[model samples]
Target: MKNFEIIANLLKEIWPEHHAKLTSEICQLSSDDAFLLDYIAEKIILIKKDKLKQAIKNYKQTCAVIVQEEIHFRRTQSYRLKTEQQADTEIYSNSSFMDMYLDGLLISQLFWSNHFKVFQFFCSSFLTQISKDDTLNRFVEIGPGHGLFLSEIVKKLPSRECLGYDISESSLRHTSQALQSLECAANVQLINKDIYNLPTDQNFDAIILSEVLEHLEAPQEILTKLSHHLTPKGLLFINVPVCSPAPDHIYLFKTPNEVQDMITSCGFRVNETRYFPMTGYSLERAIKSQATISVAAICQLST
Candidate 1:
């Protein structure tokens, strides 16, 4: 808890009001997970301290866009972007901006209370599901953006070989540094390629597509393709946001059932689903108000 205390102090320096809530939430994490949070917090402070203020500003701007988009959605019952090309112009294709955007994302996970809930869910529920599956030997993560999730996997499942694919150079760099910083000895490969470019003949015992689905124009297509790479009994973990709009987020899922139904339609039988509402909101409130909620699921190939 000393490491968490140090992180809490640092967070207090940045955002005094959030100190108590951030400390309480972080304290709830398991020891190793709490340390990982502290590590990421320290990394942000060391490498991007000057940019932290800008990152917070950018996050607020993103929130503004989300609010605007929600109004548009209410009026038209449609997402603002219908294609990836439009989204590219909006965020992902811009390398410098994307780097800042990723940093802001890390900052949110560390200091923002609601975003912290998503992190906590992954650390506890998602990790628990993976740990129970002793047969898993090979693992792959698609769009392992900040690398925290994949680093946890490599640290916990040291005997399992791991591979990660990401289309963004910034994501790949962060993921590589995260894994190396953790001193993970597990055999690992980080490939900079779109999922379509990956070999079709290879399969994995576990596949993770966390926080990657809602950004695409065709999430279902990616899910279908990934289904082929998953072994018959392999585990698949996916995380998506409901009514969560960012500069890069294109597809809008309005409800958790929509996510569940989409995964089921893609030929995976969902084993577990966890929904974390945005801070200061209940699940029902989030759904009714079109507020942000993180929805994660674990699944297996349908028989």
Candidate 2:
């Protein structure tokens, strides 16, 4: 939603730097270079700008293509790894928030320190889905582990300017690095603040409560605090793992339907719930019983 005049001014500022880089490459050519002789210096500058402009346009198109291809790739492989994770989840006799945090640190994109490419790719795909829908802007994510979600948001919707809050200092450190790598780092702010200290003056276009609520001894407190922080007309995305066991899934919602009720009770109106097809449970049984591994939703703010 930016004016062309503003964009024009930005292009003016950008052109100088672009020209400098373009010319720098030409400067490397020897004076005896046949191509340089064919065109006058003035024409060379114009051609350089023209080529640079073409490259920029191509890069934008390439990003879109890459996103589309990635979506297809994820859809194809969703089941195999999902089942593998579920089998691993069953091995944990007891898990806590701290354990989940550590596990995520090792494998989740939220933290760049983990040096895991697959997790980073997954986070990017997740954000791509969330951002394509305009309703999901003005975002805030709670307990975003290493901030992988923030990094993806930074890349996809630089105009949105998201903020994230979590209780762990180490997690915040890694999240900062993850966002910075995506070049959308300016759009997000990470705070080592608790849910009780949730900022009230700021309003979000979307709220993300991913995997953090179930770890809390009082999930209601987190939900209510988030309810107050959400924008009156914004979207909320809450993700909870269902049948899949984890070290930190101390409290369970069993199904997306159950979580929907809890969200409605807390004053938010749930609009849609999609169960992430999980492994271990037979597809037929999971569909009938409504027991899946994860829940993500689009929600409307409650009055």
Best by lDDT: 1
What's the TM-score of every candidate structure? 0.82, 0.55
What are the Cα lDDT values of the candidates? 0.75, 0.52
The TM-score leader among the candidates is 1
lDDT by residue (tens digit), candidate 2, 131-196: 677775678888776455555566557777688887666556545655554355677877887767
Candidate 2 least-lDDT 10 residues: 108-117
Q: Could you tell me the lDDT of residue 120 within candidate 1? A: 65
> Residue by residue across 1-303, what tens digits does model 1's lDDT show?
454455455556666666666555655567666665665566555534466566555544555566787777778777778777887776667777776667667667765545666666666767777678888778899998777778778777777789999887777876776567556624579999988777989899889888899889889999999999999878888888887766677788888999999999999998878888876678888888887788888899999
What TM-score does structure 1 among the candidates reach? 0.82
Q: Candidate 2, clashing residue pairs?
A: 95-247, 110-146, 110-148, 138-205, 146-175, 242-293
Show the colliding residue pairs in model 1. none
Distance from true location, Cα of 226 in model 2, Å: 1.5
